[model samples]
Target: MERTTLFHIFAAVLFLYNLPACLSRTSPNITTDQSALLALKSSVTLPPDHILVNNWTTTTPSSVCDWVGVTCGKLHGRVAALDLSNMGIIGTIPPHLGNLSFLVLLNITNNGFHGDLPEELVNIRRLQYMDVQFNKFSGQIPQWFGGFPNLVYLNVGNNSFSDSIPQDFGNLQKLKVLNMKFNQFTGFIPRIIFNMSLLELLNLKGNSLSGNLPANMCNHLPNLKFLDLSLNELEGQFPPGLQECSNLQVLSLLHNQFMGHIPSEIGNLTMLEKLYLGFNSLEGEIPNEFTNLVNLEILDLQSANLTGCIPSFLFNMSSLQWIELPYNNFFGSLPMNICPRPLLRVLVMAGNKVSGNIPTEIGNCTALTVIDLHENNFTGTIPEEFATIGYIAPEYGHEGLVSTNCDIYSFGIMMMEIFTRKKPTDEMFTSDLSLKRWVSEALVNGVTQAIDSRLIRQEEEHYFAEASCVSSIFELALNCTEESPENRINIKDALALLQKIRLEFQAKLSEN
Candidate 1:
């Protein structure tokens, strides 16, 4: 008629101009990938008919991205990593996850997820590792996360999230590992961790993080290594730019209210190993530059209002093992080379004023186990090589107690070093009577001669009531090492008979 009506009006304007590049701006018949997964389940908090859309039907949303733990990443094939860690997946967190702009690792760590955190995920420009730590996530940490330019590992630690930690995290220039510890985060702390130069492991320990710190924060984290600001309230001093962190190893400042005097340049931390300044208000001494902490192992300065002299270069710390310098004001006399490391284990110089004599080179330490010089002023004799060594001498043998069964032979030689892991001498030969008379002659000649054939485990099979709960905790460590301190058993009835043999060996290791 008019050239077939202008070829049916130019084929209906070329089918509405290829229908929005083949559909969906919001819904042409639904498709721009089903309206980008219903706009990512309407930005998650899902509920209404939420059977998580049963295999995302609306006719196969990108081939059901492999159901269940749904992990799918295949650029040329489609879908990208969405690891739902510990998926109990509760609400929040769903600004359509920035519509998975080719998501590259988004692990919703440890479930029960609560709100905030969705600043449209900084529009996920190819996101690179975002672990929503512990979870119940509250607000404030989202300053468009300093525009995550290929973000590298950001964990929202423990989570209850509060504010102040966003000096735009110094614009995470390819940041690496920033864990916000036990959160409730208040102010201070954001000098951009001194300027996070390729940072590595900075755990802000149980937070409430107060002032000071950050002066060069470990010389700008020169590849920082494990810095846990223990229980917080953090005050000043102490941050000697962590001696420019030459691979600093575990420096925990326990409790707080830190007073002065411990930085004799902390002997320039030669790969310092575990130095916890316990409690705090710390006063003098102890810094003979800690005899150059030669990879020192565990030196907890307990309660600290400390006064002089227990640092005989810490009895020559050849990799010293576990020495908690108790309650302070420490006077001299107990380090007769307090067992110069044959792997010395637990030598707590209790409460202090320490007057000498227990050192028979602590009976050549054969790895001493737990030696508390309880409330000291210590006089002589008990060293029948520690009456054979779990010696918590609460005024053992009183009135200058000249050893009549020395604190019941140092609690039957710390119950034969907790049942024969052995080491209690001073040469009383005669096959020894201490370790409490060989566990009452192995429970009257039978309960397998006081166990500890190195606590037996010959190809694990035995369960005679789990070997009679280790021979009833070696007869409650032979009734608390009795040499007859009025027939022993006291440190609160030997800790309620070892908590009733640890609840009968944890109810026989839960029935095998």
Candidate 2:
């Protein structure tokens, strides 16, 4: 019996010694994940009464899985995703977040988060989707981003990231959507990025990226549906191989320095819906092959120095909506039955040498909202159906020389119509009470009375900022519509002031 008691005592001692090790193996994983999340919470600066302030607590280890933006995997009970998007959280990301080994998605978009992304994020090898756009983050995109073999969607747009795009991005063979737009990135687009065959949406717009596009830019982008390189300094002839991207739907290369004939091969994109190649040095007639784009909705070739007759086929397209060929050298009469398609909305042929009487059949286009035919050689009385709405500038009545200032006057009227949602020819207006006069009087009384009610209803948080912005816009419009051409604000100055107003409005919004 003594021997049996000694055996029992020895076994109990061993059990006691191993009990702590067993508990450590089973419980430390959850404890470690909870600690990591707490560290992240402590690092961020939350807005007043933020949901995280109440929801993310350490009362229990299992409580983290119930936090606002945290998602835990059922199998392992580990955090699998962290989505703090639009939460207005500010601060540098804590390195402890790298402990989320099971994380497959991380989205912190539209916040005020600033600073370089933590290099420790390389530990989240399973991350497949990441969006950090519309923030204030700055610095070089980390090269280690290329190490995520499973990454599928990535967007770092609308931030202040600078320097050349990391060439290591080429290693993301599975990437489908890559957007780095509106940042300060400079230098040649990494050639290897074009080799991402699986890419569908590649938007590098509004950057300072310069260099001739690679000759074989579209050779491998077979799935590309949306390609926007607009507002850049990129220059060169159209890549002949772009036709290889048969699935392309929207191609926007506007406001670049490209100089050459637009390749006819562009017509091969039969699936294309919108095409914008304006504000470039490109010359020559639009390719006749463009008629093949049966799905085309918007075509913008303004300020491209293109010459020749405007194609009549452009008006006949059943799906066409906006046809912007302004500020070119096209000279010809508009098709008499100009817009047979009811979907057509905007027709801008201003600053061209086109000559003809205004088409009466344009009345058939019930959806038409904008018709900018200023600075043309059209002769004859304005169509009663077209001009009775009071859009005609004063210079037209006096046979004064047509100038860009005339267009400015019309632009002012359009802005008024857009904000007030009241046409110049509205029943409320008369010889004494014009749309401009009504808006001016309302501005003096209260700008909100002239602003669209929808704008006020939708932006309650930014009511003051919106009101101020609208007031400034109305004041600018009044300057543009001064009775005498000499008194009107010049188009260039008007544009600069409008941009300034936008910046100030954005600053106010951030403050709010």
Candidate 3:
């Protein structure tokens, strides 16, 4: 009787101790959520080859937390991170993913994930970085998004996300870089964005975002470095208070509806490197204060209604590389003493009202690749000594009326510069056949002969080579600058072809 009582007591204790584990085995939240996961697994059939996991041979009855790219927290064994980037994932985002309350980082960038973002995702309170860019995601961003107090970096760019930015976004004080570029987002700039003081890089380019940039836009964020509002319906002059953004580096306002002269004080941005104000209605002379921009690299005022001479201020910028002022009303002579800085690469001043003899000093710009002065009122004999103007012509001399042939000659020079990496003036000329003529002859024989010897070593021709892409680019250059203007390709076609060649070479390099 004593042995029976002792055994019964021990069994009772064991049963009582294991009660919680027993209850958890069939709990509704656990079993119900497991069924939901199974349903998600069935809704979208992943191809055999597309499955990223090696350990999980089948989707069967395994826990979702143990799946590839799904990380689980130690405390509750709940999903904490889902990194599904570049998996070529197709099908809608499963709302069942929100069942994991501990989920933090959700990255589905560079995939084919489509349809509306499920509202259930907002339950992920600890989410930090949500990257859904480069996908086909549509519909308005969920309003509950702002409730994710810890959300820091959100990239929904390059998608079909439309409608106004949520006003509640102001609640996400930790948000830093919000890239919504290349989307169909419309409506006025959300007032909520202006209140986010921590934002450093806000890119709304390539969207339909309208309304005047708030006058005090930069007043809230002193730490901003890159502010790209280009290719939008944003009108009104660049906000005057942007001067207070002392840390600003790149500010692109291209292809917008902005009018009036660019604020003269814009030169106060001493740290600015790339300033793109092209394709806007900005008129009047470039601010004289621009001369103060010592660090400026790219200054693109193309297609603006800008008037006056190409500023002498530009020639002084030693760090300058790209100078695009094409299609404006700029008039008067290019500076006579202009000597390009070593870093200078592109000089596009085409389709403007600039009139005067083509400056021979242009040949002194040894670093120049592109010198586009087409469609201007430029007169005088296309500088005959353009290939090697040993010295600057004494001011403007008695030169005659120029024809459209000047563009052809400039085109030839640009092509030679890109290939040979030598200025026309750098002892490259002596005979009647100009640089263009030499390249033309080589192309006729075979482009291999025209390849810049600098691009290859003495005896390494048979191995891996940059030859094929270079050959194609060379042929393109030869076709662009045909002496008969009618035979030459248009600028648009030329640029597109060059870009294509560049991409081809880039792909080759990446693969190797």
Among these predictions, the greatest TM-score belongs to 2
* Model 3 alpha-carbon miss at residue 410, Å: 11
RMSD of each: 20.5, 13.0, 13.3
lDDT of 3: 0.71
- Count of backbone collisions in candidate 1: 5
Estimate, for each residue in 115-230, the C-alpha lDDT of model 2 and write its tens digit.
88888898999887788899999988899989899887788999999999999999999988888999999999999999999988899999999989888888999888888999
Predictions in order: lDDT: 0.67, 0.83, 0.71
TM-score of each: 0.30, 0.75, 0.72
On residues 222-248, what C-alpha lDDT tens digit does candidate 3 reach at each position? Answer: 767778889999888756688878777
Superposed Cα deviation of residue 31, candidate 3 (Å): 10
Encode model 1's per-residue lDDT on 240-347: one tens digit a residue.
657777766777888866678887777787777888888878778787877887997888888867788777777677987888988888887876766666677788
Give me candidate 1's TM-score against the actual structure: 0.30
Task: Tell me how far the alpha carbon of residue 510 in candidate 2 is from the true structure, in angstroms, after superposition.
Answer: 20
Give lDDT: candidate 3, residue 291: 77
Error of 3 at 121 (Å): 0.8
Model 3, residue pairs in steric clash:
387-424
